[model samples]
Target: MPYVFVGSVIVGPLLGEDAVFGSLTAQLAAFAVGLPLAAITALFPLTRPMSVAAVRALCDVPGESLADGPARSRTARGRTVTWFTLHLGFGGIISGMSLALPPFAGVLIALPFAAALRGSRVGMPEVFGEGWLLALSPVIGFASLVALAGCAAGAGTLLARWAPELLGPTPADRLAAAEQRAADLAVRNRLARELHDSVGHALSAVTLQASAARRVLDKDPEFVREALTAIEETTRRTVGELDAVLGVLREGDQTAPTAPAPTLAADLDGLLKRTRAGGLRVRSAVELGPQGPDALPPMVSREAYRIVQESLSNALRHAGPDATAALRIALDGTDLEILAQNPLPATGAASRRGGGHGLRGITDRARLLGGTAEAGPVDGTWRLRVRLPLKGPHDHDHDPKKPQKPQKPQKPKESA
Candidate 1:
């Protein structure tokens, strides 16, 4: 292989000088031709050692043949040491041969074996007599070097001539790698969105309920009890949800059964009732907005409830215990308007700057319903205003009776 590789290098320069390909092109030309030739021969795979010892033996053939082969009866560790010694003697001979001939030839023989055995132990067998090996090993090692050089040179030449294309990176491998990266990025994005929605809602609820419970402790024990209950329930629910989410990542529980998801239907009414109980003086004026024929959509109700719930919760937390929280909902043309507000406290925490997921989540929910939400401090009070399009959960068209008239009806023509 070494001779063949050197021969190609020399031949390339000569061919270029002959003007087969101009002088400037020869640099690229050598690699282009050598690559295809290397592929066709499949020379490297066949000649390479399966283990460190095999590589060393091939490189230092003469030394390996003369040295004592490892006793097949030896223990694995003993045999490994014996094998290593044989290779070291082989490598030394190859290195010496390089000084006698061209340095590249020695490199072509010894370097591959060294790299293959990089992590392996390189020691001689202590059990064997050293004098016996030391004497004949050098002579055998020199002969092995010459044989390996001759073989490497022939194989490398044949590969370079016939299968150069196989030597380079393939298009298929690159495509597979790119596809894996894309899939990883997609999974990360989904996890981020789920965490944002779950943790944001739970934390906001916990904070609001805790603050309210503290204020009502002395004045209204019953109300305080209710708020405390809400806190416990919310905490327990959050933990269960988190466990289920994390369970998917655990290897030990590969077959672990997931806890059933909590249903909103059973808890929503209790959720709403408790907030009103928590010193908010909440007034519920919610009425189902008109739907074309279909019933109210589950998402619409869920989002609407969240919007009102979060706003009132914030009102209780920041607007003071004595503050009056009012919630109103009514239909305005094709939209449902939800407005929640509380009086500014005489001395209390400043208005919360943004709607918690109660606000943001509601807004995102509204957007999903083709609606919108606005929340901010308004005229000595905090206001949450939302406009939800009045399309029932299943309705995709307007009600037939409620014809959309562009102009008022003209006077009847019966008299004419």
Candidate 2:
């Protein structure tokens, strides 16, 4: 239809009244001039989306076959132009056949009956025809109409087959979509880690505290009340961190709570007390520089707090009841060192070595910050050590996870 409208303006002036019956060569020449003029319009960005929609509907193409977005690249635009040109050419041919062929066929079918109705012999269509051969004219006309119908159906099939190849996502579009999927997966994974560390640690503490209070409730009213108090604090803090973790999902919403994530600067003291509530004896020495934990980068601090929490959670779970664990956090040069060690519980020697998903999450967290995590039984005790750079993961010339020599805790360096 577009070509028909445009061609009238282009071929109409050239042929004047002969537009319908122009000489073959003259018609071809006019079409040649008008074809490029029509095709050039397809290069516009809007044309790709419009043609994609039209092809899908009119050709009955599957929704997945054509891309929904507009032409965004040279390759996509080139394919769109080719498709649009084919659309115009085939539409013009089918339309012309629909208007002219059926009536012409009908007249030929009626020609034989004309003489019979008039009761007088009449001359047939000639290159000098008059007898049984005249009967062949109607048959030929009917066949011509059938051929036109077949051509139209075949053209529809051709367009449907080509629509997917021309209109589907380009390589660039596919790549962009893939990157978006990866980023979404990364965010979901980080949330999972945070939820696990926060809730798991809290649950372990509450369970231990409840059991201790239950056993001593008759003879030790004071201890039971303290246990209940710890349980309340742990649940309340866990719920707050849980909400912060879940906020990642509602990030773009106006109604989302703006709770800050857990970090060492704010949560380390509470974490130590929570570990003690879980029936693990914790002896700790944390010496950050004079600038204190608040001087660390937010990402480093947040991930560091989780790493410590998970390590302690592992100790609480696998180091058995009432085992003393040593926790040392110190700033050593440009690196922050976290070392957690405890005697392997008499019954948990093998189990302590296999800390499962919690240990794996800790390792991933440290690696994400370009740090290293090493946890295993050292001598007769289990040890978990991690090293993270204060400047985050991007500053180092070498891999932060690379194995380095074990160093004893030293006096913290003052921040400059």
Candidate 3:
């Protein structure tokens, strides 16, 4: 119905009378004229972008001879040439209507051309497409109407003293765009916070443990044992968390939950297995003492594992292909001391820049979780230490006051 009115607007000008019957006849003629031209223009690739070699070669022919002969005889000379002439003539007529029609009539002619352009671009065939697209040709014509309206409005604004009503609805579009941008910023900030909290914490712990594992691999088997064990436990936890995060990235019907959440109890065994798979040898001695039942909180457990995983991944990236790592986790009352140490590559330039993210990510996680993470060299060895409160000094205190108690750090178990 709306389309019929738009068509009438285009032909209504061609009709001398303003009567309903005359307007209907005008609309019929507009449809009769616009459809065949749109069809011909879309069939021929008239635009520079889509014109291929063969089409270009066809277009090189001289004059209107392609259209002068019968369709049967001309097709052999070139389909593209015939189509090109047809579109050239058709486009000229549309351009003439655009120049001559009132704003409303111009809209009716412009819309269908735009629709045809869109259809051709997407490779949709025009063999039997009728109704809406055919009917909407006048809407394409209407865009010229809008261009004219804009020019008139601008001219009026410049001459506002003569016509004050020309300023139009100027503020609405600007306000909507501002609101949309603000919404986008809010979402980005939240994503940054989540990454800082999770991935960051894991990387830091892994770095520390890997350094420890490398130091004792040959000189002290018992010490190497602890580091290797920690590496495995850490890697497993990291993989699980990574899977969770990636699952969220996938778009589909929600998946059924898979592996259960990382348990609060120390399950560094899973972490150790994964690190081993990545080609890092682990020497670990991890014991969740009698108070071990008091297990690390779920957030701490997952983070602890991530710390291990990222450190080992870094080790693989930085450490020599045959590098070994050590890990040690011990409970001293309410404080959990995690130490991951790896040998400084014989050359000293071992995994310099490569290990930083795991270090930084772990540091961010530790800080957020009411803990402190630190990394770097000590006595020719690379170490990562993350001190997190298991329970706390005050129930809601900002900082806990505990003297850093050094442990009787043991040796790693010799590889069988």
The candidate scoring highest on lDDT is: 2
Q: Which tens-of-lDDT digit does each residue in 1-416 have in candidate 2?
A: 55444655667676664553345454455556656876898888888789888987788988776776778889988988898888878876787689778876776677666555223344234631565756776897799899998999999999889988988888887887789889999898888888889998899889889999999999999999999999999999988998888888888897877578889999888898878877888888777765567766678888889999988887887788768888888887888899988788787554455467888888888898888898888887889899998775544433567564544444743221
lDDT of the candidates, in the order given: 0.52, 0.79, 0.52
Predicted structure 2, TM vs. truth: 0.80
Give, for candidate 2, the lowest lDDT window spanning 10 residues.
Answer: 116-125
Residue 207, model 3, lDDT: 66
> Which window of 10 residues has the lowest lDDT sum in candidate 3?
161-170
Q: lDDT by residue for model 3 over 73-150, one digit each (tens)?
A: 222224434333443434444544455557445434643555554355544347425768657656655666776666
Please give the lDDT score for candidate 1. 0.52
Please give the TM-score that candidate 1 achieves against the real structure: 0.42
Q: Arrange candidates, best lDDT first.
A: 2, 3, 1
Collision count for each candidate, in order: 21, 0, 63
Report residue 21 deviation for candidate 2 (angstroms): 10
Q: Return the clash pairs for model 2, or none.
A: none
Question: What tens-digit string does per-residue lDDT give for candidate 1 at 160-243?
Answer: 332212212134434455687887764554344334444545666677777777866899898778778877876776677666
